[model samples]
Target: MNSRNDRTDLVDTWNGKVEEWPKVRFGDVCEIVARQVDPKLDQYAKLPHISGVNIESGTGRLLFLNTAAEDKVTSNKYLFYSGDVLYSKLRPYLRKALAVDFQGVCSADMYPLRVDRDYLDPEFTAWLLISDSFTKYADGESRRARMPKLNREQLFNWTAQIPPLSKQKTINSYIKWQFDKYIRSRMAAKAQLEAAETLPAAYLRSIFQGPEAESWLILPLGEAGEISSGITLGRRVSDRETRPVPYLRVANVKDGHLDLSDVNEIDATEAEIEKLRLKSGDLLLTEGGDADKLGRGTFWEGQIPDCIHQNHIFRIRFDPSRFCHRFVAAQIASPYGKAYFLAHAKQTTGIATINQKVLSAFPLMVPPVREQKRIALMLDARRTEAERVHSALADRLKAIERLPASILSRAFIGAR
Candidate 1:
């Protein structure tokens, strides 16, 4: 196979590349080629063809059967053959596209690509799409829009280090072997997690939708708890080092849970801890964010003796005499409850956000006192199990994520 010799270092996203890999215009290595051959959008076709890709993992598939009605399969149709790469033009940052070996018609948003194996191995091309060079190319080509998109000419202009065909095949095989293990473990763990979540969510939904056979009143959030947003932690300067206060921001709160992985040290005395320090039963809610994240709340376990939140996060404290934190977390996680908050959210800058004044008025479904404790305990147990699965899966993924760097390092820096 005709190949290039300037081949060496391939590092992780965060790592610096050593033994500089040869640079070439992406067009040199592969061609963005596809053929259009599909029926126009008659809208009468009972089952139209469709394909989507998530660029992050290069996962793509064609709609052999209609699973959704929103499949906008219009006149612009492309023939997808085995070994063809499908690239999504929208939001390259998300890397939402994949490579597939199938014969079908797909959405116009996806571009069918043909990689020249003599210069670019199909698998290696997919890997390159997820590499740093592609990221830079994406940023350069992406349009200025809410959901960024890239044009064909821009895509063709993208460049990268083109490794020889033989080297590409070798790298492709090794990467595939490693990522396959990740995919299986990730898929299975994800399935187990989804199933596990349904249990608690179903139980919570039932409690909210009644069927509980118990009385549950709809009360405003302020009536149920102390509604308070966090203070904005200003940017830290170089001199701001020896500080007592532990500052937290939106990143610290995720997926209805508190993550203290990064704590911004601040300059605050003992008196500040009183105002900033969180309690074991504190319910942390996102103050302002996208519609889906409007009312997401998490219960803090009081890991840190004293820590504060960012302005974008809200801290909700329920009256111990009434609702419990665990029960409230479950309530907010449900569809109906979340919908209520999202409804009242004021959308600005393409994001739905609720201010302290509006959030205080957000409604909550308060079940009977006894049922609250019962549901809380039940969910607490389920959450523990979910946490176990999450921890295990995360450990496995983290371990797998390091393999690429290890392999690249060994191949380049004389380490095996």
Candidate 2:
């Protein structure tokens, strides 16, 4: 048996010497198995189902499995057997492909491939589809409509370079081993990132859960100050003379901070600016987009002068004498706040929204002014530390994600 390094060396030698390997069209080595099965049929209704959403990108690993009955799949699906390569034709750029070990019915948007065992290894064929070169080819050939997708003809007509069957096995085994190690490392980084993300929330919970809870007063947010929606933008420009003033949109408000990098100008009347203008200590919250962004908000420190917020954002003015705006922001971004928003928010199509009434009725935890400042200081420090860790872990995960492309490039073309 060849050692891993020995197999890698063999690949390097083959590529470096430009050894002649059989070049074949993808269709020559694989049969496009389009066994259609109506999921509504009693015979197939209870079979396990797979789709693009069920597989992770670039790893050929199944993320989830659901029965057709459980998923309530009513459309016609493609049947796949064990050891088949499942490739998603929808959005080829997502790079979703998997080698299944169980029989199932997949979405019509997927292609269940049957490999020619005498000529190609199934695992090798799956990995080949995940490579950058193949992804680029698929992207080029896919029809550019509302949803970019590859047709059967385009996929079958694509070409691939093949090594000997034994070499293919060796390379596939080596790639799998390398991928396993990479996955472990990436998972560890992701775990660390998740832990880092939860650190600030844990700290906030600790603070609120202390003896301070007994003395804390739960009051509606409207009790602190006035809450109002921002100015609404219309398709037609205002007839009144107006100038472009920097404005905050839902995109500008993040979980705990404002992103002003792409702030745009909106024409507003002087009275509209006066009524909707954001104050230095105003807290800006998004109305809704994603479910997680229901209560997401940040304090405005007057980054842009004379800036007004859009109608999609709610501007809350709090009495500085009683509450710290930063502390309010920290609380709203915490787990407890998220749960409250998730419960009260009206949800539709994965988007959750809160109206002015709901926003005004938000339960606010108020402590002594001095205590609020202290809590805000502690939370800010902890959040900064957690963000630093999260950023570093995110960068590491990105680099790990690029490793497969690097390895594939080396395996196909000689290392530069």
Local distance difference test, each candidate: 0.64, 0.83
Expressed as tens digits, the lDDT of each residue in 190-282 for candidate 2 is: 898888877887987877666766678998888886888887888455477787899888888898778889999988888888888888989
Q: After superposition on all CA atoms, how large is the RMSD of candidate 1?
A: 12.2
Question: Model 1 lDDT vs. the true structure?
Answer: 0.64
Measured by lDDT, the strongest candidate is: 2
Error of 2 at 397 (Å): 1.6
Clashing pairs for model 1 are 26-159, 53-96, 53-97, 54-96, 54-97, 55-95, 55-96, 55-97, 56-95, 58-98
lDDT of 1 by residue, 1-416 (tens): 21233222233321243234566676665666666664443433333355554234333222245512345544656666677777777767655545666555556787777877666666566666655457556866785655677877777786555555655665665555555665676677667656665665565566677665345687888888987766555544445334557766777887567778777776654545567677778888776677777777788887876777666888888776688788888788777667777788888886887788887786677877677888889877877877786677667666655554444333323110
Write out the backbone clash pairs for model 2. Answer: none
TM-score of each: 0.49, 0.74
**Could you tell me the lDDT of residue 278 within candidate 1?**
75
